[model samples]
Target: MKKSILNLRLFNSQVHSRNVESKEKWLGYLFGPCGALLLNAIMATYLNVYYTDVLKLTAIWGGAFLVMFPLASKIIDAVTNVVMGYVIDRTRTKQGKARPWLLLSAPLVAISGILLFTVPNADLGVQAIWVTISYNLFYSFAFTIYNMSHNLMCPLSTRNTVQRGGLSVFNQISTIMMSGIVVALIFPMAIMPFLGVDKSKWILVMSFFSIVALPLTLLEYYFTKERVTEENVGKEEKKIPFLVQLKVVLSDKYMIIMLVYFLIYTIGTTLKNIGLVYYCNYVLGTYNDGVTQMLVSVIGGVPMGIGIFAVWPLAKKFGKKNVTVVGFLLYALGSAVCWMAPRSLPIVLAGQFIKNIGGLPCAYVFMALFADGLDHIEWKSGIRCDGMAMSLYNIIAVATVGIATAIFNALLSGAGYVAPELVDGVTVAAEQSKTVNDVITFSFVGLETITGLAMAGLLLFLTVEKTIGKKQQKIREYQKAEALARGEEWEEPEVKAAKEEEAFFVESEEIFRQELKLKCEKKGLNYDEELQKHIDKVSLKRKKEAEKKNKAKEKEELRLRRIEEKQREKSARLTPEQRGKKEEKARIRAERDEKKWQEELLKGEAYRAKIQAALAKRTK
Candidate 1:
């Protein structure tokens, strides 16, 4: 049994190493998020409705709790994100850093998700406490672990940028399909009418979703390969300090831009999602059944689903930022049209379809954008903070959802929207007025429109796409330099191949020289003189090659110097406070660089000691 287990383990290792090269591996990556996001969509879209309608939480309490609880949890979640990132970065395991977390988190997330919707029969205050505890447990802690790990899988899966883009497309398609299933089918067709908004029924539905999600997570784990992560498996010195990683990632202009764009984008999408139920119920007069919600979801989801395929190719052609900007503009226009349209179902559906069409680029391509930003961070800082980058990405996404929920709740409460009471397992909804309907409309259309436009404006500053090739080259150079500095045997493929070819030529040349020497001796000629001539020729050729290399190095250094000089000149033009900020940023970067240098130095010493010990052992 022991031998069999060992053999199985070795077989798994062999399969994992080859997974990245397998074209079919994308099936695993594509389906991994399906089950997870199905549950996620339900929670993000319907939890508020459940709280207000089924649990009978007052609008004021619901709004305040949703806002304040998540806001308070943000501090903890932020710390958790960063710490989890560092933990993943430092983790050394056969399963890889990010994948192990996915396995651990799958069951935890499932259990916590069920608990989040499964509050006991209690008084209002008691239920509020339960909701807070359960929500913080699941979303702030358990889900963060899962989400951060899941997102970091992209960069770790493969280093090929084109493959990364393909993965992003698959991810978006999965997410859209999941959203459609939850919003268009499950919530409306199964849960709403059949389950009748009962708390117990909601719990059952959540439990069912959670159970289905578990196996998918395992499948995802089985299918994905952490190729990039495998390369850094045993390199402890490669792990940067959390503070330094945070500083370097945050200091990146493109990172900040992507974060802001995502924040605004999340706020807009969250508000629209939260408001959709209310809009259908109050504004469209479909409170009795979830037909309008289903209709809107199906209408929006179809175009968005179809549109995702176009996004990858368009992103490749026009760049992710440009495509996203265009998408946002179209989305804003669609929202404006929705705001103006009458309460006709077809018109509303039409607007929704258009809006979803416009949202495709941002929805489908932002992960790729974030991945690009991570590369930029790695290129600029000489470190890959996939953990830190994805952690902050998760935080921004979660925080924006909270903020959007808070705003939605506040608006609902201010508009005099009332929570329904559960009597004998039936929810008695309040009679909503025009003010409530108007608030829902504005929240769904007006708010989304404004935020979408703001996202477009902010995204115009993004210029990362143009210089990605150069940045990637710099990252390769940095990696090679770091490897050499630590006395490790690492080289770029081209460089290693070139060196091997040169060595082969030198060996052949020496063989030829020996043959020539024998001939010279046989002919009673000056053998030493012929050898000297051959040595001079080879030496002169090496001199020319060395000079060429030196010239290339000098040119690169001059280019970098000019860029830095221009930056310094730009800094000189800044105001006093801005200049102070710039100086502080420079100090942090210097500190990070110094720490990196010390790590390399220590690694070099350790490597030398290792070599010396090995030599001593061999001699003995």
Candidate 2:
């Protein structure tokens, strides 16, 4: 049969390398976050500007709602992030724990994202209500589901540190490319120029992303596998209670450091995102043309693109901790450089470039480090806190989005920031007060400096890489003992793969045969006899093929052939009537076997049963 152009099987195949995972899987990992984050990118980069300048929401009560709502959403996020993680940990689905949620959350993520821009045309009170409802729906609920599950995929994908590192890189690249480069860079230059204060254009731009999100998430769900989660299936203690997982996570010192490092770094990035446009509008004097902002973004983005190939290698060689520390310090250095010449576009661009280069390790390798922390927890406590850890990781991550937004809004509002206005049919951005420009500069450049230094200090205590090897070894041994206690054979993944390759009757094949036996019994047929006959037939075919391939061998092979000839001569000594009866019995048996085989093939019952059984296991 010809394969279809859009064959999903190709995407589902497992491909492995010494360091990274399958090509298809990493691609899925790369794009899956892109799906969930596309709209998030818009919100992070443009929503504040939109709320203030376009919707003129800041005009109402000094933009108090803008500042207050995101802060309120963070409170909700604190609860939802934990609950979502706990739910994911307990979820039992055929697609694995995280992947199912990836699929389930896609539509919710899409719909909620579109609704965020669709503020109703009503009074200010009604608009506030719409914005609040839509904001919570996206951040507190829908995005929480997608983001937590997406973040959890790294730890649950594999136990191999190198592969996990590679996945982390892919995950970060997806984030930077969609949220940072594309949304922050291209959208500002291309889309935002056309979307100046037009409410409908914002909806149209968001809608395009909404349409693409569902398929991208589905791609992510299909291509990625949860090998680590699958390993826990049918275990004596399959489900670790949420409290137990939380306790395990909290008890680990490394885990706490990683979480803090992640939180501080995320806050810095969110602040930068929130303040970019304000910086462009007021400081660079490029509100109408986003060229200067785009140029600066592009300059910074170059290092990130290069970091994809460089970060893992550098981390592997220099130790993830040391490399990350250096990166964060460089981040601080870059921020200082920008602060020194806040009014110079060239200086700011240079500083941003330097800062992004410094940002590489944390941007790309944080998850690998976090996964190491999870391994440490598993080693120390014999419980994997993937769900709880990711919940907390995402709580810091998701909450920071709202926290930074609120902070930026409050700061701008307090600084007496001016919104653009319609003049002679063209919407023009208003000149901001000096206080507002200073506030924007600090948010964009100064906050990162403080956060970067803090993160670098926090990373000093993260010495996980030094002991990760020994810890992982102990974890394997612990798992082996647990498996043995449950009467299950424990084998390394490589060893198991080798055995599966060599075996004719694999576990799944035997299970299928058992079903065939039941089917035979239901028809009042002798299953044992049928099974034995099938085995004999397979053995005979294999023997014939082996002999045919070995026919050219010398000396002893000729001697055996003469002996076989002598056996035929001995049989020839029998009487004609005895030979006739023997031949007749052989002919009858061959005819009976052939008839049953043909009947089985013609009915297609055996293969149909086998396929159904396989499908049942896959979906179960």
Candidate 3:
């Protein structure tokens, strides 16, 4: 009796420890980006306004600065993204690849963000130079580092679907609260009033937010642990090269679907947010010291608040893809309503509320889908390149900000928007023509509606959710095999149970099929004929899919081989020393390729065995 009581106490203690650990990990995610996200919201929504309206850059350069600079910066920023991804993939430390970057990004991001708002008091040319330099440093470099690391934490957290879904929910909640507090409340109420449209006051406000981000980053670092990353450490040489990683990612049909969806959704959202202030001031004609802007935010935010709680349940019931499709359809409908809405406050607010509610599932739950995409890549390619995957995702996110800003500025320029001028201690905006108001309305409403519809259309092609369970199961089996190869003393209980559960399900399914065949036979039916027809159909479908995959694989391999052959031939014409270096690099690559081939072969054998066993059971 005493032994039983002691065992119960021990079990309770273990469970408590696990619960605490889980809670701590989530807390890290919740608090890590609190300050950073607030800063991002401010920049996304108002930075263009600051450049055009406040800094008078539009007056100086006539939209060239706004349009050309961001486009040019994005071109350079894309290369920087690839380099950062490579660095992250090669990095190894006790703190993990993603977390260390998170820690390092804090100060760099803070300093750059502050400087972006704090342009020097100088001539127009000097200001342009300063703005260009500072924007690249912050958005392209520092924020890239921070965001890529931030995104990687989701995949690194755990492989459990439910847990990942929960993390994504927490992530959305944090984003909503931080963005809501800054954009909805603080910017309109406190900062705008105190500064009253002065560009100089932006320096002080931005500085405050930058400083606040530092401690929050520290809290994130302390609370988060990279369990998935720990398992992947010391396998650097086994990783697919950067080019190969990119190929694998691009090969996945689901990743392509997500990429297109992200581009459309991001561009649409950015345009709407940036155009909101102009829409209120120019179209609605109710610019009461930022009150209209605040109201719009509040109206949109209320539905968003409810949506953060509502989306997960709806997704669980209807499936993530279906829920997303429905959400975007409703969002597009609401945007259409807004486009046709009268300039009435209540009507506009109602449209915005509907739009927010419709967009809730996509706003939060898509991260899990991206995680599922990574799992699919690993299952197909036998490699896990989290750094590369997250980097590409971040690039899409950051690039859209630049693209949206460029497009918005170009539209404003076309619409003949004259920059506001400061006169006699007050800034006065120029009177806009009807065309200008129309452009603002179209940008803020029509563009988003179109993009939302496009996203829904693209999501129809995504089928990852259907295969995620099997992919996860295969990943677990691979991990277990790796552990056994390393001669570990104990297996993880969760992994063991999962394997057992899978076996039981497979066995039960085989038994049920056999029973159905026997019942048909007893009923004097053509059991074998019907069974053969069903099997033949399934076999044909599987065969076609396998052929397509094999073709892609062979094409990629052929491309790689051609490139290598060309390099070798070119090296033969070089100096002895140069040829030696080239040959050495070639040798190293060959060895890595051989190792990868062997690993794939082993995995193929295991898969074939599993399939063969199931087939035999069914036939018997």
Candidate 4:
């Protein structure tokens, strides 16, 4: 039995499972961003505050310079990002496209992140020059590479929607809970109080994160697999020109929707993160030294953490877009609650908790939805858009930080916001005027309310999921045709996935048997008896897990049932003519969806033919 189990394990290990979910992959995804994002969260949450208060940049450069600097700097990144995306798409190496870039970015991010924080104590002109160069170095160059490559990993790693969703969950958790929560709660609560206005201590703190980032990034690169990227290996297909590919990606309506969605969400969150310090210092009645901000972070972070687990199941049940819409509504509702009493800590915390809960579904599943849009574009265009789509995605992710910061600084400076001053011997926060306080409050909560409502409405037009589902088989056929034209054989993704799943069961059985055999040997017991006991234990555990899942499913069903009952009651109140018109509208909508699907299918066939003919002519 032991020999057979060993043989089975070896066989399973030899059969590579592309896009199959595994513990190592999930861990890599989770740990990859921990170091970098932790540093970034710290910067996003505090760097602006540090510049305004500790460095006293406003004293040197005019107040308008603060607003113009970040916005102007992002213009460089915006252009750089597009060029980098084009370069990444054409780049081929033994380490794969994105991983090689990920590796190169590690040292760059580490060095630049530290330098950005370590602004030298020199002449005002020197300090300003140092800040500009370091800021651009860290954000425009290093962070862009890291962010783009890390995001590209997800779509390239898998085409399987379920596995993609799982990876996305881990990615979001790492960004939100691991990096975000720690920075939000711990940094402000513990570190900020200690650092005070000490620039040397700030450099020390930033350097620690810079040191941590290197190893974590290497681990992520080592463990991540770009399965979809591997699909193109040894195939000599026609390469689309950079400008043309850019046009293709930009013109995809789904990509546009995702870009807009991402921009609004990032801007809203950035505003909150940058404004929270000011809000706590001024609007909350006193500079309680980040204790109030820490409390607020914890209050909000806890619910967001819980909502992470629920996002996947809820998205699976109700669709990603539906879950996201509900989240936006909740966000708006929570913000409205906060608006009722902006100065009250308890009310603010409660509203923050509610708003954070609303943020979870979108935060967790946006990448997955964006990946689906990428797939849809591929289905239509017969090429992948990993680099192009993700570059734009990173642009929004990074640029919004600048946009938010600039907006906050502009408002604060305009309202005669007072920075901390050295009183007697120690630095103390200055009391702000009422207008400054109001601006802080608006940045903290009001921005989110408007963006949330706008996003909820805009997301209604994102219907790529429905189209992608209909075109899945056609996509596989196009891929096969393209590969055939290149004189290579192609295997269906579903077929490969099914084989891997069978190997998974074999591996599982082997492990269970090996463990049982070891236990029997140790105890001087019968292997047969131990095996039977182990099986029974495993069965009991499975039963309990199933019961838990069933209960959750029933609760979801009950909620849906309530919604349906409300709709029925509303329908009963309508006149017969109104009911008939509603039915006609539903019919028209269904017909329109069907018409669009058929049109897309026809277009896909034409594009596939062109690609195949072009490949054939080139081969000849």
Give Cα-based local distance difference scores for all models.
0.75, 0.78, 0.76, 0.80
The stretch of ten residues in a row with the least summed lDDT in candidate 1 is: 10-19
TM-score between model 3 and native: 0.76
Residues 392-472, model 3: lDDT tens digits: 877888788788889889888978988766688676777788888888888788887898788888898887776577677
RMSD of 4: 7.0
**Taking the tens digit of each residue's C-alpha lDDT, what string does model 2 give over 1-620?**
11242233333323232223455445677876687777777777887877888788986776788888888888898899899888877776545667667767889998988898999788988988898888889888988888888887888777888778888888888888886677867787888888888888888888888878888887777667676765665564545656667866776678888887878888888898888888877897668586877877887678888888898989987999999999989999999899889888888888988998998998889888888888776666666667788889888987888888888888888888888886765778778888999999998899899998999899999887776776677667767876788788898755653453346246435876798799898998888888887778878976985585577355659977998999799779989998889889989998986686556334433433443355446556
Q: What is the lDDT of candidate 2?
A: 0.78
Q: How accurate is candidate 3 locally (lDDT)?
A: 0.76
Please give, for residues 475-590, the per-residue lDDT of candidate 1 as tens digits.
67766776888898885644553564576577668888889988998999898898889889989987996797799779979988998999989988999999999889999998
Backbone clashes in each candidate structure, one number apiece? Answer: 0, 0, 0, 0
Q: Which candidate number would show the highest TM-score if scored against the true structure?
A: 4
Our tally of clashes for model 1 stands at 0
- Please give the lDDT score at residue 50 for candidate 1: 82
Better of 1 and 3 by lDDT: 3
The lDDT of model 1 is: 0.75
Clashing pairs in model 4?
Answer: none
